[model samples]
Target: MACYTKVEKETCIACGTCGAIAPEVFEYDDSGFSQSVLDNNKGVQAVPEEVAEDVEEAYEGCPSGSIKLNDTPFKPKTPVSS
Candidate 1:
């Protein structure tokens, strides 16, 4: 089975960016928190790279910076000096 997880409600500010960016991968639950719907059969039904990027963008663009994208591998990028 693939690893599947949802965003942390405590960390999610309900910006709806996840649903806007990748509805197929995320949706609002009963509490209106973003939840992951990627089901793992043999492996996790991976979100497309573009969708993944969008999710990351949502995370970064969150006004409260409270969005959390779980089950996705994230590597910190090296800072680029202007």
Candidate 2:
């Protein structure tokens, strides 16, 4: 139920877009390497509501686009009876 699903650390390139987009959910290590602070069985760090818009923006802005999100499944609506 989340769009942001996987994060390719090797391809991340450490641009810091993720951290900038979601600081509360990301942080830079002392080694100057940016790392995600959140992770789960569903995915790594579901985007926060307050910064959802920003995260999407960053996702697009990512040079490598290493950040991946889950796509919601579509549901068909039932037809009304006449």
Candidate 3:
């Protein structure tokens, strides 16, 4: 079971609600908008199992409708070996 999340950054109001609910999964960018902790995902990131509930709460609490929560399978990129 995976909880894939994405934030529509263009419309993000930087409310910080998601961050406040799940700091480990969401963070604020330089512009102060809510973004996924994992980068280079075009706003798509997998919420840790431990914080899945928090993400869900954030999604519900988001007033800008920027938070998108999904249960579909998420395949993160494999880091290249140095």
Who wins the TM-score comparison? 3
Give the alpha carbon lDDT tens digit for every residue of 1-82 in model 3. Answer: 7778878788898877888888887888777777787643353556678888888899999998988877774455489999
Backbone clash pairs for candidate 2 read 3-69, 3-70, 4-69, 5-68, 5-69
TM-score winner between 2 and 3, please give it. Answer: 3
Which 10 consecutive residues of model 1 have the lowest summed lDDT?
38-47
Q: How displaced is residue 20 in candidate 1, in Å? A: 1.6
Cα lDDT tens digits for candidate 1, 40-78: 211235556656676666666667665545474434337
- C-alpha local distance difference test of each model: 0.60, 0.59, 0.77
Q: What are the per-model numbers of colliding residue pairs?
A: 0, 5, 0
RMSD of each: 9.9, 10.8, 6.2
As for TM-score, the candidate ahead, 1 or 2, is 2
Off by over 4 Å in 3: 40-45, 73-82
* lDDT for each residue of candidate 2 in 1-82, tens digit (9 for 90 to 100): 3544345566777788877876765566565545555552125445557766765676677788776555642233378999
Q: By the TM-score metric, which is better: model 1 or model 3? A: 3
Ranking by TM-score: 3, 2, 1
Candidate 1 residues lying further than 4 Å off, grouped into runs, are: 1-5, 39-45, 69-82
Which is superior by lDDT, 1 or 3? 3
lDDT for model 2 comes to 0.59
* Candidate 1 global TM-score: 0.54
